[model samples]
Target: MNLNQLKISVRLVGAFIVVAMVGAALGLFAIFNMRTLNDADTDLYERETVGLALVKEANVQRYAAVVGLRDAVLATSAESRAAAIKRIEAGRAKSLELMAQARQKADDAESQAAYAKVDEAWKADQNALDEVLKLLAASEPMQDSPVLQHLRDVVAPPSIKVGMMMTELTQSQERRAQQVSDANTALYENSRNVMLALIVVGVVVGVGLGVVISRSVTRPLAVAVDSAERISKGDLMQPLQAQGKDETAVLLRALESMRGQLVEVVGRIRQGSQSVSLASAEIAQGNQ
Candidate 1:
């Protein structure tokens, strides 16, 4: 209740607030960091996995173009025709190599499924190309013949199937990536709102408790001052009761003891006045 006690109480409250704030900050920081990592994973997967899917589709397209061209080639004695054939073959080999690389680096289920489809499509297309290659090796033109006709018939339906499959795969990858991004954003928002609510609650509770503590400390001082005033009026029959073992109790005890001594002095003065009156009466009778 004294100044020193008030200071101690304030310091204790301050220390508690500092510790609580630090802990809250650390907890919020951890939450924020965890959310960031989650978001990053989603972003990274969207980039790497979807990119692989698109790459696989591109390779499939390249394969289809080469097979279609092979079905169109007619062997001729022209130098330009042979050169074109060789160039198309080289491109087909490069496309296959890229498809293999894409399959190796595929990271997600959707991408892996796309890679599988591309491989199956490539093998089916090769069945037709192999026959066409045989015809080309024979140095014959087959563009208007049954060999190209059979392949065009076989490759058409599958080309349609592969196209639909690739489109579906690409679409599915996009949807999953979008879902991840949306979920990550929602989680971040929820966590931020929760942390903000906690800070607000902590501030309100801390301020309310600090006020209560201040009142508790000052109430003792007010009681001590009132008791001192009562003793000053010579009304010392009852002193204030000491409340606790703290400094407030010590102050009340000292004041109570002083009040008792003052009461005794007042009694002694009253008694001495009575004696002086009686002795003066006796001396007046003797003089008469």
Candidate 2:
């Protein structure tokens, strides 16, 4: 049926339900986008950022081992040599542990491959260090020695290679994280725009509905009020135009019935007065 045929209560409830539905839909939309953003953030931090940090730590451990080896070669006394050897072993152990952690944290195939290179290079560097240490323990010469030449040619170059590989891995992960951040930022903007558009549409629909329902209710009430005013001024002949099955229609119909009954009662009273007057005249004439 038309809006005017519906009761005011039904019209109001229907409007409210429409607005609630729109609100719920927008809320769910926002929640889904937010969940996506949260997942992206987690992946960026846990998979990429943390992995970068661990690889850097591994490189630092490799540098420490290099320093220990240099000091062991230059040790002047037996006690100093023993202490340097102990420090060198400790640095090697720490380097291995840090590299393992870095490998475990690597996320993608590229990053895993880079870690593998670092691992292979580190193993060769360790083997070279072991050779140098053996010569140091035998009290080999400090300058122009095969151990010094090996350190300069083999161990030093591979140590640099490992550092370079780790640096490249760190840069790659940073770029990936930046890409994720940019994507998430774009998604956020799109979601905000959609939400704003939905809000505007909802407001427009609500206002339009309110105006229609108000006119539907108030127009009939205005007609009923005018009818009642005329009837109060003793003009009860015309019937009320009750258009709908709503409350206002019911009230108007009742008013129309009451006006008809009042008009009939007034006509009966006038007739009775006329009959009494005629009877009085007859009685007076008879008396005369």
Residues 196-266 of candidate 2 have per-residue lDDT tens digits of: 67776776677667767778777888888888899889887778888789998898889888988998998
Candidate 1 per-residue lDDT over residues 187-233, each given as its tens digit: 87787788778876876677667667766666677777787788777
Output the lDDT of residue 256, model 1. 80
Question: What's the true lDDT of residue 255 in model 2?
Answer: 88
User: What is the lDDT, from 0 to 100, of the residue 198 in candidate 1?
Assistant: 84
Instruction: Give the Cα-based TM-score of candidate 2 against the true structure.
Output: 0.52
Worst 10 residues of 2 by lDDT: 140-149
TM-score, one value per model: 0.57, 0.52
Candidate with the greatest lDDT versus the true structure: 2
Q: In candidate 1, list every pair of residues with a backbone clash.
A: none
